[model samples]
Target: MASVQHPFPPLLSQDSADIERWLLALNDVYASDEVALIRKACEFAAPLYHDEVDVTGASLLQHALGSASILIGLHMDHETIAATALHAVPNHLQDWREVLTTRFGANVTRLVAGISDMERLRHFSELREAAIADKQEAAQQVEGLRKMLLAMVEDIRVVLIKLAERTQTLRNLSSASPDTQQHIAQETRSIFGPLANRLGVWQLKWELEDLSLRYLEPLLYKKVAKLLDERRVDREKYIADIVAQLQSALAAQGIKGEVNGRPKHIHSIINKMKRKQMEFSELYDIRAVRVQVKDVENCYAALSVVHELWPAIHSEFDDYIANPKPNGYQSLHTAVLGPRDLAVEVQIRTPQMHHDSELGVAAHWRYKENKQSESGFDEKIAWLRQILAWKAELADSGEMKEQFKNELLQDRVYVFTPQGKVIDLPKGATPVDFAYVVHTDLGHRTRGAKLDGSIAPLNTKLQTGQRVEILTAKQGGPSRDWLSPKLGFLQSARSRAKVRHWFSEQNVDDSIAQGRALLDRELVRVGVTDINQEKLAQKLKFNKLDDLLASLGRGEITPRRVSLAIGQEAPVNAPRASTQTIATSDGNVVIEGVGNLVSRTAKCCSPTKGDEIIGYVTRDRGITIHRRDCPFMQRVPEEREDRLLEARWVAKTN
Candidate 1:
C-alpha cells in the first residue's frame, strides 16, 4: 500500500503544518475529547500508515469526525474517530478490530466490520495475474466493484467518512497528477456532489463544486477569487449603504425585518462569469443584502420599503413572492443604485424561507436524534429530486458545466395560471412547457393559449408576472412535428420520454395492423388459405403468426430464407428474397413459409410487367418475388426442392 504507484497517496502525507494547526483548533474547542480521538485515530492507523507526516491518516480522520459531529449530532470519542481513519482501508481489518475492542468493545467492531468493502481485493485478483486483455473493461470492473461495496454497508457513517477522505484526496491529487486530478475532480463533480446534493448537504454540495472548480479550472477560479478580493472594500460598503437605506425606508412604513449582507461564493462568481460571458466588472450582484422578515406579508412590505428608498432598476426586478418557483423558492429580488452610485442587490423573504434557501433541506431532517427535528428540509430534497429528473441526461455530455450553470444561474420568470396558480419556469419557457407543468395531458392536448388575456399560439414565451390560460381539447394531442429540435421545452428528456411513449404505442398498433394484413395476403395466396392459420403458425414453431409477420415486416425474418428452409418454390416475378418488407396501402405483403407457397412479384424488387422474373418461397414469411437472374434470390434455400409453391399474378385488378 505504501508503494510509489499505489492508487491513493496515504491520507496523512504532506501538509503537516496545516493538519497540526487544524488539530490544535479542534483541541482548543473540544479539549480532551478532540485530543483523545486524534491520538487514538493516529495510533489505530499507525501500522498501515507511514511514519512520515505526509502519509498519516490523521487529517482526513479529524475532518471526518468533525463532519460526523455536525451531521449525526454526536461528540465523537476515540473509537468513532479511529473508525473514520480506517474506513478507507480494508487491508488493516485486524487493527480496526483490535482498536474497536479496546475502546468501545464488540458493538463498534461490528459497525466497523460492516463497512469493510475489500477495497484492496485487487491485490488478490486472478485477472490481474493474467495480463488484462482489455484495460477499458478492467476500469469498469473497478468502479462497479467500488459501487457494490459502498452499497453493501448499512451504516451511513462509513459513507460520510469516505466522502471526506475522497474530497481530501481530490484536493491533494490535483497538485500530484494533473490528469488524475482532473479525472477524479470530474468524478467527484458527477457522483459525489450529486450524492451530497441528494442527501441535502448543501454545505458539502458547495464544497464539492468549489473544490472541483479549483482543480479543473484553476485559472478561472483564481480570476474569480482575485476579483472578489479586489472588491472586498467596495462590497462591504455597497451592502452597508443598502442596509442603511432599507432600514430607514422600512421604518417609514413601520415595517421591521432582519437584514444582513453576504457575499457570493467564489465558485458562484466564476459561474456568473462563464454563463454571462462577461468580465468581472459586468456582474452587479457581488454583495447582496438579505431581508428575513417574521412573515410572508412583511417580507413583501420590507421589499416595498426598500424599493421606495432606492430607485429600483426597472428591468431587474423579480417577484418570486406572489409566484414562487416550482421548487418552492419564494423571494423578492431587486437591484438598486445605493449611496456613492454603487449597485446593490436586495433579497427579501421570510426567516424560514431564508433558512430553507441556504441549506436547501439539509437544515431540516428527522434523523435519529433524541431531539425532535424539522420537516421542511426533507421537502426541499423533493426539490432536488425534481432537478435531478431534468439533469440525468446531462451526465453523458461529459460536462458538469450545465449542472453548475443550471443550479447557479439566476435568470428566471414567474407567471401565473388564469386560476391564480403560480408557475415558476426558466426565462424562456413557452406555454407548452407551462401546460406540461400543469399536467402532461394538458400539454399533449393543448389547442391554443391565452397570454395576458390575449389569444396566443402554444409557443408563446412567458414573461414574468403575466397571466396564462391554456386551451385544450379532447380531440387533440402532441403533433409529431413538435418533437422537432426547435421546440426547446419539449426537447427535455421527461417530455421526450412521454411523447416517445405515446408514439411507440401508436407504432405498436400500426405494426399489428401491418402484420395482420400481410398474413391475410399470404394465406389467401395459398389453396388452404381459409383453414385455421393458427395451426399453421404452431407448425412453423411460432406461438402467434403475427410475430412471424412482424419479423418479416421489420426485416428480421427473410421470406426467401424461410421458403428455402421449408422446401417451397419461389415466385418468378416476386421481389428478390431479402429481409426488407415494403409497406403498402393494402398493408404489409410478405411470404408465408410454413405451408406450400406460391410465386408472386417479389416485394423487394417489384418486377415490372414485361420483365424476366423468379419467385422463392420462405419458411417463415410468405413467398418472395425477385428478378429472373438476381444472384441474391438464387442464393437462399440452396437445398430444398420439393417445398416450392406454384403461383402466377393476373392482370391488374383495378
Candidate 2:
C-alpha cells in the first residue's frame, strides 16, 4: 500500500522552540533514559515525516511531536511517547518495522505495531461519505465504533496514542479543508470522546469533546465560551472567596481536604444546558467547588461544614455517597445560596472517589451509561491505568520492563474480520475460533479458512489485524476433530463446546453407530471378548443399547467402566459373593435376577454406588437399573410396568 501523506503544515515544523518545549514538559515525569528514548524516537522520525503533512496541512513531524506531547501530559510511559513519535513511520518507510525492532527493542516495536493497527481504524472511521443524520443510527454506529476501537488494540497505551493523535488533529483543524475538518470533528465527537470518557481519561476526553464541539457547532461553542469569559474573573474571585471560607472552617475543625473551583468547560456547559433544557441562569453548577477529602468519613464531614456555612437549596441536595451511581461513582452534591445571594454547586467526595470519577470507569458522565458491569475490555483498560499509576509510584524501579511484560495483555489477541469487524479471542485462536465468535452457525459450517486472503490451516493462530475469511459448506456441521485436543484445530473452549454440542445433538442413529464403534475399539483395547452389550447397557443404567453406545461416543462414559463392569479389573473393596446374593462392584446393588443379569446404575440420574436402584427389563436388553425418580422410568409405558422390579444394596462381607 502506498503511504498516505498529510497535506497540511506541521505544528512543530522547523521549530526547535516547540520541540524543546515538548522535551521540557517531560522533565518532571520522565527519567533521563526515558527522556533519551523519546528524544531518540523524535530524531529518528523527524527525517522520515519531515516532508509529509497531516490533513490540516501541518507537518507530520510536528503532528507527531504534538501527539507525543499529549501522551506526556497524560503521564504515559516513555514507550508510549516514543511510539507516538514514530506512529506514522511504518506507513511512510519500507522496512520500518524491522528497523524499529532493531533499534527500539520489542516493546517499542510492539507499540508501533499497535499504532499501525489503529491507523486502519482511523481510515475506516474517516471514510464516511457524509455525516449520518439519523440520530439513533448515528448513535449506534458511533457506539459500535467505540467498541471496535477498544477491541482492536492489545495495549491500552495504543488507544491513548490514538486519542492523542486525534486530539492533535482537532487542535490543528484550522488548516484543513472544511469537509475534512467536519469529518474529523464528527469522528472525534462521536467516537473518540466517548472512548476517552469510558477509559476515564479526563484530560483527553475534555479536549476531544471541547475541540469537536468548537468545529462542529462553531456558533454554539463561541456563545458558551463568550458567556463563560464575560464573567470569568468575577466567578473565579467568588469561587476563590468561598473556597477560602471553606478552607478556614475545615482547618478550624481539624479536617484535611482540598477545596478547588470547578471550571465547567464550554462543551460540558452547552451539553448540560441542552440535556436538562435549562437556561444559563438556572445552572448553579456553572460556578462550582469540589471538596476532596481523604476518606468516606471526611467526605461527609466536609459536606456538613459546607452546609453549615451556607443555606443549601432544598431540592438541590444529593447524597451520592450514601447512594452511589450505578457505575460505582460516589459524591455528595449540594447547590447552596452563597454570598451575594448567588447560587453555587458543591461536590464533596473522598480522594479515591474523585480519582474514580475522573480516571476510572465511573467517569464524568456516570449517570449517562449505567452499564451493569464493566466488560473484560473495560477491566483491561482499568488494569492498564493501574499500571500507569504504579509507574508513577515506582518511577525509580529497574524492574519496569519485567513488570510490564507480566501485566500486559498476554492471553487475548484482537483481530479483524475481512470487513473490519473486530473479533477478540484467546491468543492462540484460529479461524475456526474467529468463526465461532462471529456466530455459532458460521463455526458449524466452517469448512475452510483464509488468512489475509490466502488459504491457511484451520488451526492457524491469528495475529492482530489479520483479516480472516471463513469458508463454510452450504450445509454442514463442525467436524468432531475440531473438538479433539490432539488435532490442534481449536484453542477456544467456547468453540470446542459448540462443536461438542452439535455432535451431541446429532441424529441418534449416527451417534449410536459412532458410539458402538468407539465401544468396540475400547473393549478390544481392554481385552474384553464377547461382552454382553445388553448387560453392559443395563449395568450402566442406559435404558436402551443405543443410549449406552451413544454415551460412550459422546465421551460421557469412560472405557475403564466397561472393564470394571465385566469384572476384568475389580474395583476397590469389591464384594466377593457370587451365588444367589451376587454383589455388584461397590456393593451398591445386588442382582435380583438369576444368571448374571447385568445390573448397573443409570447415567442419566447418576445414582451413586450405594443409592437405591430399581431394575427395568428392556427387550433384547438386560435389566437397566434406574433411580426410582428417574425421568425415563416415570415416562415408561404402562405395558412396561411389569418390567420394573425391586432392587437393593448388598451388605458387603468384611
Candidate 3:
C-alpha cells in the first residue's frame, strides 16, 4: 500500500511528528501492534488529506487527528481511534474501502464506512431547522434524524466517532462564517449534545453543550463565564481548603478516597438558573467536590465523613447507589454548608462508577469488548434510545425514571422522504401509513407509492434507510381495502383510523344512495321487497333510516345484519336478557358468562349498543370491550387468545 504512488508525497517530518505524538499519547492504553496500526492509518490518511481544508477552514488531517485525540480521551479501542484517523478517506479516495480493508482489516473498513454513512445525515441537519415550518414537527423530525443516525450504523463506535468529529468541528467553529457557525452550533445543541448525553458520554456532552452555547448564545455564555472567572480565585481557594479538610477527615476515619473539585460548565449553569429560577450565587453545586473510593462501602464512609465535617442539607441529599439511573450511573449526591457558611455540593462514588460516569457507554467497550452477548448489547442500545425518547420528561420528574424501567423499546423503521426528511414508523409500516404520518390529506389522495425510485405496492413494508415517495392523486379517498387487516395495506392503527374517518366524513346523500343500492340488492337476493325500512332501522337501533344506510355505506354495518334484524319481532325498546351482565359505568356493554367485573370501552374501537363487540381481559383493568372486527383486536397475537371473551349489548331496562 505504501508503494502505490499518488498526488501527495510521503509523510513529511511534521506529519511524522504528529503521528508520534498521537502514538505517545495512546501508548499507555494501546499495545505496540495497536499503536503501530494507528501510526500506519495516520500516515495513510495524512497524504490523502494533504492541502485539504474542511468547512471550518482547518486542515482535514488536523481535524482527523483532533477527532482521534478526543476518542483517545474516551479510552476507545485502537480500531475506533484508527478508523477516526481515516474517517474522511471515502471523500478523498474512490477506492478507500478496499484500501482500508487491505491495509488495516475489515473492522476498520466497516467503521470508516459507518462514518461515511453518518456524514450523509449532516445534510439533513443543516436544513432541518430552517426548512421546517412547524416547530413541533421540526423537533419531531430532528428526533427522527437522530434515530436514523443510530439505525444507519451497525456498530455503536460509529456513533461515538461521529460525536467526536462534531465536537472537533465545534472546537474549530470560530474560524467559520457567522452563518456557518450558527448552523453548526444549533445542530450540535439540538442533536449531538443530547446524543452524547443519552450515550452517557459526559465528557463529550459537557464540552459539546458548552461550545455550542458559546456560539449559539455568546452573550449569555460570556456572562456566565465572566461570573465564574470573577470568582475563580476565591472559589479555588475555598474548594482547596474544603478538599484538604475532607481528605484529612477521611484519613482519620480509615477511609481511602480521592477528592477533587468539580468544575461547572457555563451551559449547565445557565440551565440551572433558568430551570430553578435562581441566581448564580444561590446555586449549591457551583463550588462542588467529587470523591472516588475503592468500593461501595467506602463511598458511604466518605459521604458520612463529609456530612460529619459539614452541616448537611437534608433535602439536597440523593442516594443513587441504591438506585442507579436508567443509564447505569451510580453516585451519592449531597449539598451542605462548608466553612464560612458557604454552600457546597459533594458527590461520592467508586472509581469504577466514576470511570463509567465519564465515559458512559464508551466504558462498556473496554470491558465487554468481544465478551458481551448480542442481547446485552441490544439492551444498552435500547436504553440509549429510551433516553432519547424521554429526554425532556426525564429532567422534570422522578416518576419518569420509574417509567424507564419498563422496556418500551418497539422495533422502529426509519426512512427518508423525497426531500431528505426522515420519517420514523413501526416495523411493518406501509406507504399509506407513511403518507398519513406525513399528512392526512396526502394519505387520502395517495394512489400509489415508489420506494427508492421504483414503483411498488402501497402495502409494501418499509425498511430503514429507504427513500419513500408517495404517488398521490388530485382528489380521492383511501380504499376500504386498507382497513382490512388481512390485506396488510395499512399497518398503523392511526393510519387506519384516518381512512375510516375519511369514509365517515363522506356526503350523507351519497352514502345513503350507495347503501340503498346495496340493501336493495340484498333484499332481492333474499326475495323480499315489501319490508318497512323505517321499522328495520328502528329495530337496528338507528335513530333514522339514513343513519342505517350511512353506517352501511361506511362499512360499519353489514347488509346481512339488516336482513337478520328483519325477522325479529321485538320492538326497539324491548328488554330481553337478565342473565349474567357485566356492565360498564354507563351500562352499555354486557359481558356474557362474567358478572361483577368492571369494564370500559376500548378507545381504539368505540363500540356502540348496535355494534358487534367482544371482551378482552386485561391485566390491571378488569375487561376492555372492543368491536368484534377492530383492527387492534384482530392483530392481537395467538398467545393472548385466552384473554378474548364473548360480550354483547344488553337492552336497557327502565
TM per model?
Answer: 0.46, 0.67, 0.74
Stretches of candidate 1 off by over 4 Å are: 1-63, 66-86, 89-91, 94-180, 194-200, 314-330, 366-387, 390-654
Clashes of each: 46, 10, 0
Report the lDDT tens digits of candidate 2 across residue range 76-122: 56777788888988877788888999988888999888888767765
How large an RMSD does model 2 have? Answer: 12.3
lDDT for each candidate structure: 0.54, 0.71, 0.79
TM-score of 1: 0.46
lDDT of 1: 0.54
Best to worst by TM-score, what's the order?
3, 2, 1
Candidate 3 per-residue C-alpha lDDT over 1-654 given as tens digits, one digit per residue, 9 for 90 to 100: 001112222222236675576567666677878888898998888888888888898788788877777777777788998999899899988888888899999999999999888887667455645788998988888877887777677888998998988888887899999999998898888889878877878888888999999988899889889999999999999999999999999999999889999888888889989988999999999999999999998988888898889999988998889977656778999999999999999999998999888888887775233555457767786656543462654745766656555534347788888887888788899999999999999999999999989999998999877889999899988886676566788888788778878878898887788788877875664445466788889888999899998887775665655654543433434333232465554555655445566778899988877877777889985888888789988787533554665566766664
Q: Which candidate do you rate higher for TM-score, 1 or 3?
A: 3
lDDT tens readout by residue for model 1, 174-237: 4455666676676566456655544444445566777877787888788778877887896777
Which prediction has more favorable TM-score, 1 or 2?
2
What's the true lDDT of residue 597 in model 1? 41
Q: Tell me the deviation in Å of residue 651 in model 3.
A: 38
Residue 139 of model 1 has an lDDT of 44
